[model samples]
Target: MRLPLTSRRSHHRSVCVLLSALLCSGLACAQASYRIATEGTYRPWSFKDAQGALQGWDVDIANALCERMKARCEILAQDWDGIIPGLMARKYDMIVASMAITEQRRQRVDFSDKYKDTISRFVAQKGTRQDVSPSALKGKTIGVQRGSIQANYLSQNYKNSDLKFYDTPQAAELDLVAGRVEYILGNMVTYYVGFMKTAESANFAFVGPDLKGGLLGDGNGIAVRKGDVELLSKINAALAAIRADGTYDRITAKYFPFKLM
Candidate 1:
């Protein structure tokens, strides 16, 4: 039974439409399931609580963004050293750890808009000379988080200093209190939360100039693989929605009553 040429063409068109619909559905499903990675040790940014549940400003923000995007998010914990490499290997869809957006890292991955701004400060025993500069710290030991902007800054500016890197900022703070390092370089917020809140830190004060922008980045932002423009756009839109609806303000206020954003 030879069908007419028109009939055959119509059948082919129908099949093509069905295949297109299926392909689109598959892509949507893939996009809906996003895997986010975070360093589960940086307090107030992303970390696991005593109960082993991840909680922090970044975790809250990530959850809100996921809700707005109507996506199923899976937050995974990865070591700080392997974070960028894991993303490059496609181990996760994005990184929400307190990642500073610098030009050097931009060459490897893309970053979303700055969600929080922070200034770097040097913490030393109270009454210590406030005039100490990065150069003044040369030949002395300084404590900082491994793979942090503070470490990078010291490596570039004060190469002569013996930089001690710790897995967590709390570790560095402990070493600082113990006098293992002459000074500690870290973000202002974390330093305030950890050190200023403690009675012992009353003798410790932040010295030197406030560090911001430039190599340290305007603030902390989420990182995504290069060429993942679609995911990046969606995440950015979600962030904007949260900010506009006052969700961001509420969250920020809960952690920092003063001006931190």
Candidate 2:
């Protein structure tokens, strides 16, 4: 009961075609896998949980975008200062570390459309002078994260003030609590959620008016190496898709009570 040679040959060809299709699909999945970088010390944006797993607004947003793109992502915690350099070195495809979209940063890396907006502020002991003017802060000591927009703003405007820069936001907060610094400057939302709301920050309050525009930058964006148009395009598209489908809102709700964008 052997089949005709022609029939057997056709069946064999069909199997070969099926196998080839399956192999191609697998290859496509592997190709889509990407490495993404984030500043794990920045809480409510990107930070490790008690279990040491990265979980925050930025990480969730990155995950949502990857889902829209149908890509597999490996999120890595990178130091803030080295995040861009790592991307340029091809260590990661892009950075989802809530980096601001600024003229200075744009010279080194391209960015996706902003996913969130933010303002900077100064936090000091409740009884301290609330003025953020340069003259008032002239001799005061301020703790700020190194290379941040807050640090830049203070350096340019409050030149007479003493600026103490730290490698991470948490370090700055610790210094502020210990009274080593007269004030601390950082994102309003971060301080409100990560520090202000904490038990240790009970005596501290936001002093300055919300600082926006100028050197503060417009909003937070995902960063990619300069001239990485293809990856930038994909990130922008996925970001748009997630926002339109409500995935972005859902993630934001988990971390913030107010709209960031």
Candidate 3:
């Protein structure tokens, strides 16, 4: 049954009040609960399984951190582009969507210490000889996820390449597989686990050395809104606790063949 309009407004206010006490307050606040937001489409990090249940390294790590903090936690799916705005609007408490910790992003929101470090690499169809250098890849089409550090990297390093930006990395992968683009730039671990492990990717392989530094950022971390110092500190501590107790290792093993932390 639907509630009266007044009742609905009251409920909304109550939710915000509760969240403010916990999310925007000092760690000593009484409310011990929070909601974590994820893109829920990044494979091996935070994606739904065949059963439609959310399952991935990021989900597990968020859950583990919540446990260590003795807090009530809910992992919610959100669009990648709006994740940060949602956090700022109090729609969620934190972001655990394999977002990199970068200086540009830091201006908008704070981030916890890195939970995993992955390198950006180039992938292309096998038997294609190409160099990632600007002059060599000139006129060659490249696919990259919009708003990602990889896109920034491509812009800075390969200005001569024709760049196609997709909202999701998966879209870029689809374009790469369909021969729409000669190359794709993204995290090495993501491509390996999400595509390269599959039979369809048999013909595709790494085309150049892994790219790092300058624009790619440090690594993936839990993101919270700026000025939310108390909540951020607690999350950082919880992240450390999970790693110390081996929970982080277990989650990484489930999705990746190599260590990310």
| Best-fitting candidate, scored by lDDT | 2
* Model 2 accuracy (lDDT, Cα): 0.90
Worst 10 residues of 2 by lDDT: 23-32
Model 3 Cα lDDT, one tens digit per residue, 1-261 = 999999999999999999888776775666599999998888878889888888888899888999988999999999887888999999999998989888889999999988888698889999877567778799999999887889888888888889999998889988998999999999898888788988878899998777776679888788998888989899999888888888888888887778886
Alpha carbon deviation, residue 250, candidate 3 (Å): 1.2
Instruction: Give the per-residue lDDT of model 2 (tens digit) for 1-261.
Output: 898999999999999999888878756636588899999999989989999999999999988888888888999999988888899999999999888888989999998998889799899999887788999988999999998888888888989999999999899999999989989999999998899989999999999698988799989899988888988899999988988988889998898898888
Clashes of 1: 1
- Error in Å for residue 73 of model 1: 0.4
Report how far residue 64 has shifted in candidate 3, in Å. Answer: 0.3
Number of backbone collisions per candidate: 1, 0, 0
| lDDT values, one for every candidate | 0.86, 0.90, 0.87
Judge candidate 3 at residue 171 and give its lDDT.
95
- The better-scoring model by lDDT among 1 and 3 is 3
Top TM-score hit:
2
| Candidate 2, position 210, lDDT | 84
lDDT score of residue 259 within candidate 1? 59
Ranking by TM-score: 2, 1, 3
Q: What is the TM-score of each candidate against the true structure?
A: 0.87, 0.91, 0.86
Write out the backbone clash pairs for model 2: none
